[model samples]
Target: MTDLNSKPEIDAPEGPAPEGLEIVDIVVGDGAEATPGATVDVHYLGVAYDSGEEFDSSWGRGQSINFPLDRLIAGWQQGIPGMKVGGRRKLVVPPHLAYGPAGSGHQLSGQTLIFVIDLLGVS
Candidate 1:
């Protein structure tokens, strides 16, 4: 069973990185739904798709984060909506949807990323 209160581990990716954004629901919640522009409070873990190396994690920090959907990466902005509070979701984000193509300056640029997110609240 998926645990809502703990950090999630992502399995090593297989095959080449996908060319587009992919969303999967690990646990569906019945609470308030997230809207396109809603601010959300969530616990999340992020890893590089190719290496499966962890890059960021709210869980590691021992706290959740709150941010507006519009302020997040494209994949997140696109994938997070329609998810409800108490849900857990997985997103496979291509470089374009994540940081961007190579040489974009950001360290994560040119890299595909995977994220497991647990939604705690939305407003």
Candidate 2:
């Protein structure tokens, strides 16, 4: 039998994000929910939509990252709230909410970013 709790593969979207950022829960957690301004620790995989290339991932390095929810990119700041600790979420962030027209680094210029995030803690 398949484990119901297993995480599915998160792929970049080929189509446009439907009006505003799209947030979907992959695995629901019973822990505390993340709030604005909260310092959160999470594991995230970032993919470029155009070529479905992974630009970054905390899981690859076997380490999680911690940052204030409000201090991240506009897309992350808006989308991270309401996520529960130990939960996983998928976010489809459009250009405006992402890095905008300038984008980030060389691989992500003017790209729509897709992220699969696992919320590890909130403090």
Candidate 3:
């Protein structure tokens, strides 16, 4: 199970946040690669980019979430595409591609967000 209170270990970006989305591999997997329009199952931890305060986790709930790659936020839609099943990646999402200026819920707003995601499978 995931440790809900644990902060994510985000590496310093090789350069500035890219113009679109940035994905860094934490664990390279040999499973099937994710592609646009594919349904994917994943466990993820979301946090603020500046503070690393965890805001959401699927593992904390003891379950993984499944969704179509094209239906998620622009940042996620862009970043998750090229990952492989069983792979772990860190996604640095700029506000423009995430929730944008409106943000989402109460935890994120206009701030860049970071997510550590584990791709479980693609169906």
Per-residue CA lDDT of model 1 for 1-123, tens digit only, reads 998988999999899999989999999999999999999999999999989999999998999999999999999999999999999999999999999999999999999999999999999
* C-alpha lDDT score of every prediction, in listed order: 0.96, 0.79, 0.78
Q: Model 2: runs farther than 4 Å from truth?
A: 1-8, 17-19, 103-107
| Ten contiguous residues minimizing lDDT sum, candidate 1 | 2-11
lDDT of 2: 0.79
Total clashes, candidate 1? 0
Measured with C-alpha atoms, the lDDT of residue 10 in candidate 2 is 64
Backbone collisions counted per model: 0, 0, 0
| TM-score for each of the candidates | 0.99, 0.85, 0.81
Which residue pairs in model 1 clash with each other? none
- Candidate 2 colliding pairs: none
What's the best-to-worst order under TM-score?
1, 2, 3
Q: Taking the tens digit of each residue's C-alpha lDDT, what string does model 2 give over 10-97?
A: 6546566555788988887679999989999988888877778788988778788999987888889998999998788889887878
Off by over 4 Å in 3: 1-19, 102-107
Question: On a 0 to 100 scale, what is the lDDT of residue 69 in model 3?
Answer: 86
